[model samples]
Target chain A: MRTEDFLRDITAIRGLSGDEGPVADFVADAFRPYCDEVWVDQMHNVIARKKGGGPKVMFAAHLDEIGLMVVNIEEDGSLRLGQVGGVDPRILPGQRVWVYGKDRLLGIIGAKAPHLLSAEERSKNYQREDLYVDLGLPPQRVREQVQIGDQVQLEHRYTALQNGRVAVKTSDDRACVAMMFEALKQLQNLRHEADLYFVATAQEEVGTRGAITSAFALDPDFAVALDVCHADTPGAPAWRTHKLDSLVASMGPFIHPVLRGKLVEVAKEQNISLQTAVVPRSTFTDADGIGEARAGVPTVLLELPLKNMHTTVETLDSKNLREGGRLLAQFAVAVNEGWEDELWT
Target chain B: MLRDTLQTLLGAYGPTGQEHLVADKVRELLSGHVDSMRTDALGNLIVEKFGAEENAKTIMISAHMDHIGLVVTDIEKEGFLRVHAVGGISPRLVAARKVVFADGTPGIVALEPNTKGKKEPEMSDLFVDIGADSREEAEKLVSIGDVAVYAPDFTALGRHKVASPAMDNRCACALLVELLMYAEGQKNTIVGVFSTQEEVGLRGARVAAYAVEPDIGLALDVTAWGDTPQTKLPAVKLGAGPAVKIMDRSMIASPYVRDKLFEAAQAAGVAVQREVLAFGGTDGGAIQLSRGGVPTGTLSIPCRYVHSANEVIDLRDMEGALKVLLQFIELA
Candidate 1:
C-alpha cells in the first residue's frame, strides 16, 4: 500500500487504546505481502518478521490512537466523556466524533455555548466532565445504541496541505505505522543479515503495552520505535521541537547511546534530513518500554515531526514520513551488517 | 511463616528502575520450586512450574518486586540529599518518614518548614537528611541516582494484620513465592513473573507478559480499602478476602477472566471481594493489554494506607488470594 493510502485507511479505523481490533487487522493485511510471516500477537500487536541469520532488528509503531470513551449517558441523550489516552478537553468542544457502539454513530462533543457561558467559565480551561457527546438521538435510543465504555474517535478526513504536509486525526502514530510499512517495503529486495520484524504495537497512548510484549517475544538484538514528536510552531519552544519537514532522532537516558549514534551515522550516510532531541527520562514512546525489556534491548526512537499532537487536526510533512522510512530501512540494513559489534563495544 | 516472608521481602530495597537485589532474593526463594527460571530484559524474574499435561495452556501469575521510593538527584552543601520520586510518592507521605538507602544508610525525609503558609508542600521542598555535616560526607554515603525506600518496622497488628513498608507489592511477591511452594500439580504451565518497575509504569509486566505469552494472566497486588472513617468509594475493606479486580485506571479486567476467577473462588470455597478502584493500576493492567490482549484480571489483597510507610494487609486476605489462584490455575 502507498504511504498516503495506508495512513488514510488506518487513521479512518477506530483503534482506541484497549480497543484496537479494526486497525490491527488493517495493518496485518498491509504487512502480509512484504513479510515472510505476519501474525497478530495476544495484545493485537501485528508482528511481521523477515527471517535471516544475523542480529534481529524490530521496528515498532503503535496502532492505538488517543480518543474518548463513553463514561456515562446523561438524561438528555448526550454522553459523558472519559479519555482513552490523553484527549485534550480544550479541542473537544464542537468537534465531531464517531461513537463506536452497536453501530458507528455520528456525534458532536458539546459544551455550554460561549454566548451563554459567564466570563469566568469561558476563561477557564474545560474539563472532560464538562464536555458531552450529543448523538442527536432520544435518551432511550442513545442508551440503546451507545453504551457506556464504547470508544469514540474524532471524525477527520485526510487532507494534503499546501507544502506537502498532511492533516489527520491520528497522525501522532498512524503516520509512523505507515512509515514503518513503507520502510518494510523498501527493504523487501535488500539482502539484510538481521531478521527484521515490523511490529504495529497497540495501546501506546495509554502505555507502551504492545512494545513491551512484542519486544520480549521477538527478543531482538536492537529495536527502533517510530512515532511522531511535536513540531516547532509559532509559540512552542524551538529547542524542544523539530521541524515538520525533518526526521527527529531521539537521544536520551531511555534510548541506547550506541543505537542513537548508529542512527545518526546512518542518517548522515544515507543523506536523510534528521534532527536530534534529548529526552532526559521517559521518551513517552514504545522505545522506553522496548529499551528496558528483559536483560534490556538496545532501542532508539525515530520521530516524524508532527504538529498539533493529540488533537483532531494533527499535521505532519509527508516528506518527513518518507525520510523516516528510508532512514529505518538503512538502519536495519546497517544493523544487518554487524552494527552489534559497535553497539556492544 | 507468611509474615516472616513478607517482612524479608518488604525490608529489601528494590526501587523502580533498580530491582536487581529484589529479583535476586526472589530468585533464591523460588529456585527450588520452579523447573526453570530467567530474568528478562526489564529485570522481570520469570520462573516456570511445569504441568503434567504437555499442551496445557500457559498461565502467567505476576507480582511487581519494585516499590515507590525516592531517588537522589543531588547532594546539597549541608549534606541533605535532593531527591525525586521513583514512582508516585506523595509529598505528604514522604515528610517526616524514615528512609533507608540500598547500603543500609538511614535518613529522615523532611519537608522545608512552610514559612509562607503554603497548604501542601511540593516534592521539591522535601529533602533527605542523613546527619552528614558536609556534601563530601553525604557523597561518601549516597551517590547521585541512588534510590532509598521508606524504612518502616514490620509489626503484626492483632492476629491477622501486619503493617510494613511496600506492602502494596512485596505482599504480592511473597504470595506468588508461597504459591510456587504450595500450589502443587498445576494443570497449566505456570509462569511466576516477579516484575520490576511496576510502580514506575507497569514496565516489567508489559514485557514479562509478552515473554511469557500466557493464555491467562493474573496480577497479585494490593488494593485500597475503605474500612477507614470518611471512606466512601471502592467499598473494599481489609480482611474481606482477596478482591477480584473489575477495573482501574490502566485497563478493565477482561469479563471472561474476571468471571473465571469468580468461578474458581466459588469452586474452592474461598470468599473474594470485588474491586473497582477509582485510581491506581496493577500489573494486570499491562498484562491484559499485552499482545492482541490476554485474558487478564487481578487478585488484590486488600490493604489499608497503601503507598505509605505503614501499609497494612490481612494474612487471611493473602491466603484467600492463594486459594483462588491455585483453583484458577487448575480449573481454567
Candidate 2:
C-alpha cells in the first residue's frame, strides 16, 4: 500500500487506547496477503507472521491514538472529558472533535471566550476538566446519542502538505504502522531466513499494554518497535529533537545497546539518513515493555521524526517513512544472517 | 506467619523496574502451595492452582511486589548522592528519612537546612548521606543507578494497627500468600500474580492479565483511609475491614464483581466498606481492561499514611479481607 493511502485508511478509524478493535482488524486484513498466517491476540494486537526456520524477529508498531472519552453529560448539552492518554489542555480550546457514540456526532471543544472571562480567569490556564465538548443538540437528544465512556477523537483529516510532508491527527503511530506495511511490501520477494512477525500492537498510547503481552506470546529473539519522535520545529529544542527527513534510532536503558548498534549499522549499510535519540530511562514506546518481557528480549526503537506530536496537526516527512521501511527490511535480513551472535556478546 | 512474611516482603529492597528480590522471596513462599509457578517478562510471579472441574472459570488475583524508592542519579562532592524517584515519592517525604540500598548499605536522606526561608524542598535540593567523607567514599559505597528504599521499621502502633515501609503493597502480597495457603478446593482455576512495577504505572499487571486471560480479576492492594483529623476524603477508616472498591483514578470496579464480593463478605459475616478513592490506581485498573476486559474489582485494606515510610494498616482489616476473598474463591 502507498504510504499516504495507508495513513488515510488507518487514521480514519478511531482506535483509542484499550479500544483498538477496528484498527487491528484493518491491519490484519491489510497484512493477510503478505504473511503465511495473520491473527489478532487476546489484547487485540494484530500479528502477521512469515514463517521461516531460523530465529524469529518482530517488527511492532502501535495502532492506537490519543483521544478523549466522555465522562459525564451535562444538562446544558455538553460532555465532560477524560483523556485516554497524555493531552495538553492548552491545545484543547477551539478544537474540533468527533464523538463516537451510538452515532458519530460532530462537536467542538468549548472554551470560555476571552470577552466573557474576567482578567483573573483569563490569566490562568484552563484545566482539562474545565473543558467540555459542545455537540449542537438538545440535552435529551445528546444524552440519547452519547453515553459515558464513548471515545471522542479529534476531527482532523489527512492533508498532503508541501515538500513531501503529510499532516494528520495521529501521525505519532499510524504513520509507523504504514511504514511497517511498506517494509513488508518491500520484503515480498526477499528470501530471508528468519521468521518475520509484523505486529500492529494495541493500547501503546496508554501504557504499552499490547506490546507487553504480544512480546511474551511471540517470544522473538529480538524485536524492533517503530513509532514517532519529536521533530525539530521552530519552537522545539534542536538538541532534543530530530529532523523530519531522517529516521531516529533510540538508545536508552530500556533498549538493548547491542540491538541499537545493529540498527545503526543497518541504517549505514542501507545508506539511510538516521539520527540518534539518547533516552536515559524509559523510551515510553512499545520497545520499553517489549524489551522487558519474560527474561528479556533485545529490543530497539526505530522512530520517524514527527512535528507537533500529540496534537491535531502532527506532520511527518514521507521520505523518512520510505527510508525507515527500507532500513527495517535490511535489519531483518541482517538479523537472519547472524545478528544474534553479536547481540549475545 | 503472615505478619512475618509481610515483614520480610516490606523489608526487601524491590524497587519498581527492579523486583527480583521480592519475586525471589514470593517464589519461595508460593513454592509449596501452587501447582505450578513461573515468572513473566516483567518479573511478575504467576502461581497457578488448578480447580477440580474441567470447565471452570479462570480467576486471577494480583498484588504488586514493587515499591517506590530513590535511585542514585549522580554522586555529589563530600559523599552525598543525588537521587531521582523511581515512582511517585513526594519531595515532602524525602527529607531526613533513613534509607538502605539493595546491598544493605544504610544512608540518611537529608536536605539543606532551611536558612533561606520556610519553603518546601525540591528533590534536587535533597541528597542521601551515607556517612561518606568525600565523593570517592560515596562512590565506593553506592554506585550510580543503585536503588535504595526506606529502611524497614515495622512497628506496632496500637492494639490493631501496625506501621511499616512498603506496607502499601507488601501487605497485599502477604494477603495473597495467606489466601493461597487457606483458600483450598476452589472450583475455578486460580492464578495468583505477584505483579511487579505497579508503582510505575501498573506495568506488570497488564501483561500478567493478558497471559492469564482470567474471567474474573481481583487486585489486592491498599487504599487511603480518610479518618485522619481535618482530612478531605470520604469516611473510610482503619479497622473497617476490607474496602470494596467502587471507583478510583484508574478504573471503576465492575458492578457484577463488586456485588459478588459484597455477597461473599456478607456470607462470611465480614464487614466491608466501599471505597471511592479520589487519586491513586491499583493493579485492578490494568487487569479489568486486559484483553477483551475481565470483570475486575479490588479488595482494599484500609491504610493510613499511604506511600510513606510509616504506612499503617489494621490487622483486623487484613484478616477480614482474607476471609472475604476466601469465601469468594470457594463460592466461585
Candidate 3:
C-alpha cells in the first residue's frame, strides 16, 4: 500500500478505546489476508498469527482511539461529555464534533460567550460540567436523536499540506494500525523461524488493558508496540515533543529496558532516524499494562511522531507512518532470526 | 499444623518492607518440599513445582504476606508517637490496642476511646504510647521512622473459629502452604506466590499476575462474613466452607472458572456457597485484565471483623477450601 493509502485507511477506522469492536473487525479483515489466522480475544484485542518454525515474536498496535463518551443527555438537547481517555477541555470548546448518537448527530462543543463572562470568570479554568455539546436541533428532536453513552469524535477532514504532512481525527493510534497492516503485507512471503503475532489492541486509551490480557495469552519471547508519539509543533511543549526526523520510542514507566535498547539498535542498523519519548511514569499506551501481564513479558513501545494529538487536526507525515511500519517489520525479522538470547541474557 | 504455621508466621516481626523475617521462616518451611524457589524484585516469594509435561502452562496462586500497621510520622516532646495507618485501619478498633515494632518492642496505641454518646476519634487524633518520658528517650527505643503492627495474639473462638490480628489474609497464606504440602507430585505445574501489599490496592497481585500470566488465576483472600448479630443473616458466615467468588466489584468471575470451581466442590463433596460482594475489589481484577486476559476467579474464606486487629475465621472453612482447590488443580 502507498503511504497515503495506509494513512487514509487508518483515519477511516473509528474506534474510541472502550468501544473497539468495529475497528477490531476492520483490523482482522486486513490482517487475515497476510497471516495464517486472525482471532480476537475478550478485550477485543485482535491477534493475527503468521506461523514460522521457531520461537514466537508478538507485535502489538492499539486499535482504539481517544475521544468522548456521552455521559448524560441534558434536557436542553445539549450533551454532557465524559472523557474516554484524556481530553483537554481547553482544546475541546468551539471545536466541531460528530456525536455518534442514535443517529449521526452533528454538534459543536459550546463555550460560554466571552461577551457574557466577567473578567474573573474568563480567568478561571472551565470544567467539563460547565460546558456541553450543542446540536442545531430542538430539545425534543435531539432527545429522539442522541442518547446517553453515545460516542463522539472531532469531525475533521484528512488534508495533505505542502510539505507532505497529513492531518485528521484519531491519528494518535489508528495511524499505527494502518502501518502494521501495510507491514504485514510486506512480510507475507518472508521465511522466518519465530511465529509473528500482529495484534491490534483495544481499550488502550483508557488503560493498557487489552494488551495486558492479549500479551499474556500469546506469551511470546518478545513484544513490540507500535503507537503514536508527540511531534514538535508550534506552541507544543518543548520538553515533551521531539523532532519528527528521529524515530520515537517510549522510555520510562512501561518500556522494558532491554527491549527498548534492542529496538533502538534495530533502528540504528536500518539507519532509521530515532528519538526518545521520556515517559517518566507511564506512557499512556498499551505497554504499561502489557509489560506486567503474565509474570513479565519484555515490551518495547515504538511511536510515530504526530502533531496536535487528541485534536481534530492530529497531523503526521505520510512518510513517517510508513517508516514506523518498516521499523517494526525490521525489528520482527531481527527477532525471527535471534533476539531471545539477548533478551534472557 | 495450620495453627502452628500461623503462630510462626504471625509471631515473626515483619510488616511490609521489613518482611525478611517472615520470608526467611517461609523459606525454611518449604525448603525441601518445592522443586525451586526464588524471591522476585518486589520481594514476593515465588515457589515453583514443575508439571509432568514439559513447558506445561504455568498457574500462579497468590496470597499476600503483608499486614496493616502504623508508620511513625511524628514524635511529640512528651514521647507520644503520631502514626499514619499504612494499610486500612478502623480508627475505632485501634485505640488502646497493644502494638509490636519490627524490633519486637511492645507499646500501646493510646487514643481517646469512644464513650456513650461520643463519636470515635479519627487516626489523626490518636497516638502510640511507648511509656517514654521524653522524645530523646523514645528515640532510643523506637525511632520516628519506625513501623509497628497490632501485637500477635490468636484465640480460639466459638465453633472452631480462630481470631487473630493478621487472619484477614494470613488464613489464605496458610491454605496455600497446606496445598503445597498435599500437592506432592501433582500432574500440573503450580507457581505459589506469597505476594506483598495486597492490603494496599492489590499491588503485589497486580505484578505477580502479570509476570506469571496464568491461563487461570484464583486469589485466596478473606471475604466479609455477615453471620454476626449486627450483620445480615444467611450471608457469608464462618464454617460455611470456601466461598466461591461469583462476582466482586473488581471483576465478574468468568463462567468457565465458576463452573470449574463448582464442579470441584460438587465432586469433592465440600460445602460451598456463592459470593457476590457489593463493594471492595481483589487481585482478581488485576488478573482478569492481565495480557489479553485470563479466566480469573477467587476463593474467599469467610472472615468476621475484616481489616481489624482480630479477624476471625473457622478452620473447617479453610479445610473445605483446600479440598476444592486441590481437586481443581489436580485436573487443571
> Which is the leading candidate under lDDT?
2
Tens-place lDDT digits, model 1, residues A247-309: 988888889888888889999999998888988989889998888777898888889888898
Q: Please give the distance, in angstroms, between residue B46's alpha carbon in candidate 1 and its true position after superposition.
A: 12
The better-scoring model by TM-score among 1 and 3 is 1
Q: Write the per-residue lDDT of candidate 1 for residues B1-332, one digit (tens) a residue.
A: 66677777887788888888888888777767889989888889989998878889888999999889999999999999999998989989889999998889999998898987889888889999999999999999999999899985798899999899888799999999988888677788889999998987899998888778889999988988877887634657788788887667877676567879999999889888766665899999878867546878888899898889899999998888888888888877
Docking class of 1: incorrect
Cα-based RMSD of the predictions, in order? 7.3, 8.2, 10.0
DockQ of each candidate, alpha-carbon based: 0.15, 0.07, 0.17
Best by DockQ: 3
Worst 10 residues of 2 chain A by lDDT: A335-344
Report the C-alpha lDDT of model 3 over B73-162, residue by residue, as the tens digit: 988899889998887887778888999998778889887545545576788878999999989988889887798888999888987888
Error of 1 at B168 (Å): 6.6
TM-score of each: 0.68, 0.67, 0.60
Cα lDDT of model 2 by residue, A1-345, tens digit: 686788887888877776677888999999898889999865678999988888899899999888887766778988878777788888899999999989999999998788988898989998887899998899999988986556789887888899989888888798998998888888887778889999998878767877877887888898999989999989777888988899989887888898888888888887898888998988899998788877888898999999888988899998888888888888877776577787768
Give per-residue lDDT, candidate 1, residue B164: 90
Candidate numbers, best lDDT first, in rank order: 2, 1, 3
